[model samples]
Target: MKKLYFVHLLNDYSGSPRVLNQTITALRQQGNDCTLFVGSSGHGVLDELDVATHTFTYKRFDNRWLTLLAYVWSQVALFFALVWRVRPEAVVLVNTMLPFGAALAARLRGAKVVYHVHETSIRPAALKSFLRRVIACCASKVIYVSKYLQVQEGIAGVPAVTVYNGLSEAFQRQAMATAYQPVRKGRFNVLMLASLKAYKGVNEFVALAAALAEDPLLKFTLVLNASQREVDEYFASRSVPCNLEIYPASSNVASFYGDASLVLNLSHVDGWIETFGLTILEAMSFGIPTIVPPVGGPIELVCDGVEGYQIDALNHELLVRTVVRLSKDSQLCQALSERARAKASEFSTANFQKKIVMVFDEL
Candidate 1:
């Protein structure tokens, strides 16, 4: 059995943590010893994992200076701890580019370091450059979540592989039980599940809701990956339409998918490109059609006219037209749903587990 060490910066109900949760669980089932190093500030999806967890205190702040200081300090602490405790036989798998200290520690102790890259749109151009340099200098192998990410952030000499994200069996079962059904008439719900960030197209979603408010049957739901207090504070100065319902982070998204006629991902390509869209796959598992950004990993999940249309979030007219077209024509919606369900079955957890385990075994 292999001894594996996993490190991630945040433990929020976001994409990276959820992916890490799946990786750790799958690896442990293969009889490998797993250890996790993560932040203790957020109580999220990673909390339920059955493995040895070592947490460090770290919190994010609005001020860039304070956030940078906290991040640097966490890495310093992690470096010392790992240097003292890590065995030479262990392989350290850093989840994102943020936890470079793990790579450094592993290299110092003669352990191998693998980078599972998921994002390319890191803020502050200088930091992004520095992180890539760290990966080039320290990582022995690189695993990218999507083909697009591999091309965007790949280093020239590093060995790289692409592994698409997969949906959990529980998620598939829940979707099948709750959402696989005939389309309802008279009420159409358009859903967008994302974090409460401006670049996530929160304003665009609200605008779309307002534009369609005259139609009594049309409604919009925005689920943010944040606490209730954060949700309230974010919309304090903004105007929310009557047809739009904004909610905080939720663990149970099957209910929303069940009620949804269509789902969307409106992240801006320039500000924050989506590395891999797990929510799009989740919606597809429910046979729910989606509209996602035209660029990045989301394009891989959704073909322009096959499963769903690819449109830029900044194009307000196109967004409205697509939503209206889907709303008015049930035949088109059903066709897309059928194709979407078929497409979703191609990304299975069993396949993902087998392939990812093979990578670990080879390492």
Candidate 2:
């Protein structure tokens, strides 16, 4: 069995971290030795895993100097510690930016470095791009979550692979069993599940809600896990339509899928036109149609008039018209939901693990 070490700078339970946890579990089940390194202050989703854990003094921040300094120090300590303890054969780094330090350390200790790309979008800063290009050149292998992301980033050559995100069987079963309930008392239920970040277009959702306020039949709800403080502050600053409700992010995401008539994701800039479309997949698994902007990730997942509609832009008029049409056509909704569920099955966890193991064996 080959020894593999996975390093994650932060341990928050985001999509990337969840995927990391799933990958580690899959690797361990195949009899490979796996270890996880995480930040001392952050909480990891992999606590249940039986792998060895190493803590480092690191933090996630936009401040480049502080972040880099912490990473350098932590990696230095980790390298010496691992040298005398468990000398891994290979190392997988989670994020592109933070992996440079770890990769350098691993190389010094004679270990192969695999860089995983989870950041779908890049900042417009020139310095950031330069740093990323330097790291990309040093990686032995690059893994992208979506092909669209690779193309968008202009990452050519160097043996790159696309591995989409996977959903667990439990999540799939919950989605398949979920039944959509009609709006009571002429109220239409629409949900936006995303973090309260600027790119996620929560403000656009708010604008859409405001535009739909004239219609007594429409009600909106936002299920946000990250940026709770930002969302709360935004809500406190403005007068949202009475029909709109902002729900905090919940672990019981299945219920959120079950309760909504439609799911919405309107990102301003996405790497892949909806690379894996996890939320859209979840909504589809629950047999609900979704609406997304005609941009990255969503375009790839939503089939225009089939599974879902893509807005021309974040225009209120376009979203209002689309939602009205879908809400009125029950047959259309049913057809789309059926097709979406079928599509979601392609990204099951079993299939994901099988593909990953196959790739590892080939390597």
The top-ranked prediction according to lDDT is 1
| lDDT digits (tens) for residues 47-133 of candidate 2 | 656788887676655576776667667667655655554344665554545545566666567666666776645444654576467
Task: Give the per-residue Cα lDDT of candidate 2 at 250.
Answer: 59
TM-score versus the correct structure, for each prediction: 0.97, 0.86
Q: After superposition, how far is residue 65 of candidate 1 from its true place, in Å?
A: 1.9
Candidate 1 overall lDDT versus native: 0.88
Give the residue spans of candidate 1 off by over 4 A: 179-185
Model 1 Cα lDDT, one tens digit per residue, 135-240: 9988889989999999988899999999888877788778767644334556888999998888999989999999999988788999999999999988999888
- Top model number, TM-score: 1
Residue 251 in candidate 2 has what lDDT?
A: 61
Worst 10 residues of 1 by lDDT: 177-186
Q: Each candidate's root-mean-square deviation in Å? A: 1.3, 3.1
Off by over 4 Å in 2: 41-44, 47-50, 60-88, 95-97, 181-186, 227-230, 270-275
